[model samples]
Target: MPIDHLNPPTGAMADNVIGFARALRKAGLPIGPGAAIDALAALQLIEIGKRADVYATLEAIFVKRHEHALIFHQAFDLFFRAEEDWKQMLDSVPLPDDARRKPPPASRRVQEAMAQPLKGEEREAPQEQEIKLSVSDREVLQKKDFAQMSAAEIAEVTRAIATMRLPQAELRTRRTRPDRQGVRLDLRRTLRASLRTGGDIVDIRRLGLIDKPAPIVALLDISGSMSEYTRLFLHFLHAITDARKRVSVFLFGTRLTNVTRALRARDPDEALASCTASVEDWAGGTRISASLHNFNKLWGRRVLGQGAIVLLISDGLEREADSQLAFEMDRLHRSCRKLIWLNPLLRFDGFEPKAQGIKMMLPHVDEFRPVHNLTSIDGLIKALSAPTSGHHGPLIRPAA
Candidate 1:
């Protein structure tokens, strides 16, 4: 196949490399001008007899950003090397040829997804329609599991999460001290300010608005074990940001790092790529208590306003099962509206809060949910809507 017919390895458009880079960016490859020029130069250097060889060369630059690697590989395979196949089968609109088309491997957990609809048909919210979920199995029998998934699959899941929103976040008043923006005037503060007016001999007015910014703070774990799930959750937080403005996202591994601003990008892939660029502790160890203590000290005041719902996302596996874990949990619980703990380990059929870490964190959380697969995520959406439902701890494990 001649190069022109096969998109000419992106020819004269080489000067229009920025456009190509943008296309790659949309296609979920972490592309930039520098890389595009490199891609063009590499093509000139390498023998392009085989399409695969050329593709491998390009993949090197685009996939440098770890998360985008899978995406670049998938889009590269599908877009280039069109062959006569997709054209030949255009009438049929069939799948690509075998060399290009591979079936879902035998280990596909189709049964796991089958056990539940992930999200039931009842909640008919338009923006939240993409909230489809996959299950998290406690005993992951499959290796190279999340690692083996194509970028397209993960992208679909990521997009679904990006648009998801909570329909029922009804606000309730916990206590009122009276301030500027709220319904009542602060008797104390108003009186203090009025004292300036000579004990309010004239028109009396109040100052200072005391309304809180709705309540919810998320402290997520992006350690090696929780990496795949955490990546998805970041997308979920992005969706939540749209649904609820000013939502904070803190990622933890051996230590704590904040990526709230990065995930706020208007574009999902761009947002995820920016997030990937900001974090160095991508696949490292977990330190729950340490992370919470750091969060409780550093971020507790800024984002944890209005009795915020503290979401602790991590598997309760402390490298050192110290008592500070409980102390931090106690502090975290006391400081928020509700402390909700999400553990992917809870996806196990026979899961029990067995680990010292899990046991320590369990009692701290007002609610505990799994975060392993898509179904678990969908359930999380449901849980968000009607948190009072009696179906709280119903463990529906995925069968092989």
Candidate 2:
């Protein structure tokens, strides 16, 4: 049955509800006609004049996931509230003028949704305007910082990241395979083959070294300072995990939680949702030293074998910067083939290893690279593919 057929809402109220549903759909919510019907049905039980009741009714019908809450809230505010009040609220600028002028992360998509015309609704003709086609917006978005992006931009970036392919650099192993031009000859095989030719040696089998992708162990910080970058890095990890089997992921804030299984989900959204549910210390305090110590003691030997590469993604802002931190860092470095530190803080031009934790950890990392934007991520990919010329050694300060 059509949604309008049930309960038969007054013309104005029904139109508003349908338009609101359309707006939500535009804003990336998965609201369908059934949800709209349900919302209308729900409204019948509650007083529509009560704002809280209306908000609850619509939210209960529309939202299905935790991350969708923010988008739903923004959409509700813009759709149900008076148009002039919303315009005024959005227009009001806060102090520190420049800081207040920027829109909240979800506001951009909410505004876009509001501007979309509902079906069968009379719309004013758009004013004539010149259309200038230029470079694709995606090219521009690649360089944008993850922290500054809106919800829609994040969705776009997530899709782009899911399609990104990691460079496969094979590591030599002790295992060997048969090859005609191998360095070592297989005498047994050669002798057995000679028997087939009536004691005449026609060919010799040789064995060569086997190569495979080194395991990738990621230790990502989920502390307050590193929250923005961690989420995006998780998306990257999910993509790589789906592509490669030997990848392991760990999340650390006040403690360490191995999220390898959680990230193994094929859907990025589902993977992140699982990660969020499993991790308890997200956006909490930083305890780099303790987390590293835990990893070195419990997980290092397991995942750091067979020329594994460790990607340490953090800002190196430790709440407990002590000798143990350095010791753990050294042990971790020694266990892995390469210890690359990916710090979003390195995006700054004048960044230095001034923080106590950074100074302690810098001596152990093979490479120190930024990871705040897509371009920086691309740089990391290139760095991983290229050969490393040993560890860079301890940090050396320049003379003033």
Which candidate's TM-score is highest? 2
Instruction: List, residue by residue over 173-203, the lDDT tens digit for candidate 1.
Output: 4555444456554566657776778887343
Instruction: Put down candidate 2 lDDT per residue, 1-400, tens digits, no spaces.
Output: 5445568465667667787888887676888988887888777777666666677778888888765766777777666544443333233322233222433444665786787655463433211110111135656777788999987678667767877777565567778889888999898899999999999989988998776777899999999888989999898888888668999999999989999998886546657878888989999999999999899989988898878889999999987899999999999999888888999887777787899999899888877888888888887777667653343334323111
Q: How far in Å is the alpha carbon of 360 misplaced in model 1? A: 1.3
Q: What residue runs in model 2 are displaced by over 4 Å at the alpha carbon? A: 1-135, 387-400
lDDT against the true structure, per candidate, is 0.61, 0.77
Worst 10 residues of 2 by lDDT: 125-134
Error of 2 at 28 (Å): 12
Model 1 misplaced regions, further than 4 Å: 1-150, 174-213, 387-400
lDDT score for candidate 2 against the true structure: 0.77
Query: What TM-score, over all chains together, does every model reach?
Result: 0.55, 0.67
